[model samples]
Target: MSFDIRPAVPPDAAAACEVLRRSITECCVQDHQNDPDILAAWLGNKHPAMVASWFESPTNYSLVAVRGDDIVGVSLLTGAGKLALCYLLPEAQRQGAGSALLRRLERQAIELGMKTLYLHSTATAEGFFAAHGYRRDGNVRSPYGVETILFWKPLAEGAEPESKRKRFCNCNSA
Candidate 1:
């Protein structure tokens, strides 16, 4: 199936949140182990209302991959160069959606004049980030005692001399 990757909007929050919740619960079982408290605490900030707020936040950039009417994947990037979120439904895994979403965020980062990008990956997603050129930068314990792997990668070379909004961003799509 083909997926259309586009910037997220407030109206997309509820559906996007479903993909987030389902992906985290089913795909990250290795990290959470079906622990109720951990899941609650981990998902506490993921409420649908909160997700909607992110769509309007000036300092954040979010994207979604839609297949027909379903939101199959989602990603969020902060002005501080953090990849705050990246999740895809089980059925969408292994396709190019994740890579496309990530590449778009990296391009947006370069356009925003960011030289470095970082994120904390769940145990289940460590390989995905590593495969995208993110390195092991450090480790941080989540509030639930899960060891999240911190990763960072330098944005591509050539910071064009132009306005931030119009800068030329040549992000790699590999």
Candidate 2:
């Protein structure tokens, strides 16, 4: 029932991937419709080795939510403040783990001087992100045909997000 979130080391990649895969396969049934082939295709590029490599890469910052020695949820934030990955196992859902993981990622983004945080949320997770104040910008179809919501939340309170701001260019002939 208790869990802690922490920066992920390379060795945690396998467990993190397991958490992610279980979330996708079990918790996101509506997105994949219980199609094994679709799930396989969705996970083909997300091998544990690739997850480990991402942990070693400078472009990504990964985090894991652990209960005891087991990872219950996982997330990876990119250098650009994009939440490139996030998921919680079925057992971890609705227990404050996902929200805590997101809050941790947002804190890290703010520490990195990011103005906003963005993520593509699966249909199953859209409400979760929305509840945390992420605004829906649009929708996108994944390469494998899963529909996702493009969402972003401003890190600094009351600041106008650049993506939602109006721009005017003045042009005059002198």
lDDT of each: 0.81, 0.78
Clashing pairs in 2: none
State in Å the error of residue 102, model 2: 0.7
Candidate 2 TM-score over all chains jointly: 0.88
After best superposition, candidate 2 residue 94: deviation in angstroms?
1.1
- Which segments of model 1 are wrong by more than 4 Å? 156-174
Please provide, for model 1 over 138-165, each residue's C-alpha lDDT reduced to its tens digit, 9 standing for 90 to 100: 6777665577887778885742222232
Clashes of 2: 0
Task: Estimate TM-scores for all models.
Answer: 0.88, 0.88
